[model samples]
Target: MTTPPRPWPGLFISFEGIDGSGKSTQARQLYESLRSGGHDPLLTREPGGSPGAEEIRALVLQGDPDRWSAETELLLFTAARRDHMERAILPALQAGRTVICDRFADSTRMYQGRGGLRDKVDALHDLMIGIDPDLTLLIDMPAEAGLARAKSRATDEERFEDFGLDLQQRMRDGFLALAAAAPARFRVIDGNRDMDSVARDVHATVLRELAPSS
Candidate 1:
């Protein structure tokens, strides 16, 4: 007799947003909560998941314009992601752990494709869709407000962070469009509210989708 299909035990969740959108904070909190509830959840960030990816992250986040370009930025991100998936994320998922990524392909789609270089965003997005997240939580906030929050935390900015407000606005719009297009996979959380409220919303969404084992 033919065997029935086995249930997919693992889940993949991704957090995405512009800088200062509070994604990292919520991601960590969710990770802790999931672990406390007896679930195997691995918390990781994009551009820096594996050892090799971490080095690439340093180059991407710590460079000046002279050392970085739009194409270079996009390719470096892809390289890190490829390694991370091979070494970290895919294995975790296969082992029945919830893989929570702070950022994923969406960031490149927003930052490099939409905000910086509009020509290659589609191809990049397609590359990511090949191995997509089971659930993607998009923390949405105003570009200006996010920038203000970002500046308060750091006196300096990175190469990508130095982009103009107009570009940031475009990135926000791009994220919104993505969420609208993928209602099943993307949850758009209103991040203009306080941090606790945002986390609550994100947590609620996760519970609804994952129903975390007791």
Candidate 2:
């Protein structure tokens, strides 16, 4: 196995899933739960976590779907992520605060990797951003259901969603494959249930992972 990145004092947890799998909701709930328990936790999202990243996000998410090629999009995402890590994530982690992110490098692997860019994505991640979340919660569900939920959101950030259900199905498979490849770092949660039930499971999983080692 590849050597992991240097460790930080703070815990890093990331939530990932197909759009509308409720991963974002779960991430926010976890942040609130931790904060209510007296933990200093920061809740943030990808492609726009920092000021510079938000600018890049607009470039990536809005405008013509064909405005940029897949490779260009990958580069933009990487640049934004780099800014996010240096300006936001690393600072918080070094200060001993837990960080909960809505999405991370895995999204790049699944979204852009579909066009034979998987190896490139991995290489860029290793070279530019070497850190991985200590725990990753993948909210798994059927693509059709996820898409339906996503469509209901009616957000301006519809670039990815505009790809439609077929692409979503492929992305779902890719996410599962990724989780299977890194079982220790990943917890696959069934996201087809009620919000409260899913939140309970997520909270429990997080607590188990954060428990002190004997």
Query: What TM-score fits each model?
Result: 0.88, 0.95
The Cα error of candidate 1 at residue 93, in Å, is 0.4
Q: What is the lDDT of residue 67 in candidate 1?
A: 75
Q: Write the per-residue lDDT of candidate 2 for residues 1-214, one digit (tens) a residue.
A: 3434438878889999999899999998999999898989989989889999999999998877678899999999999999999999999999988899999999999997778999999999999999889989999999999999998996788888888999999999999999999998999999999999999999999887666655
Candidate 1 is scored at a TM of 0.88
Tens digits of per-residue lDDT for model 1, 3-46: 32223467889999888788989999999888888888999998
Q: Which sections of candidate 1 miss by over 4 Å?
A: 1-8, 115-129, 155-157, 212-214
Give the top-scoring candidate (TM-score): 2
Taken over the whole model, the C-alpha lDDT of each candidate is 0.81, 0.91
Q: In candidate 1, what residue range of length 10 has the lowest lDDT sum?
A: 1-10
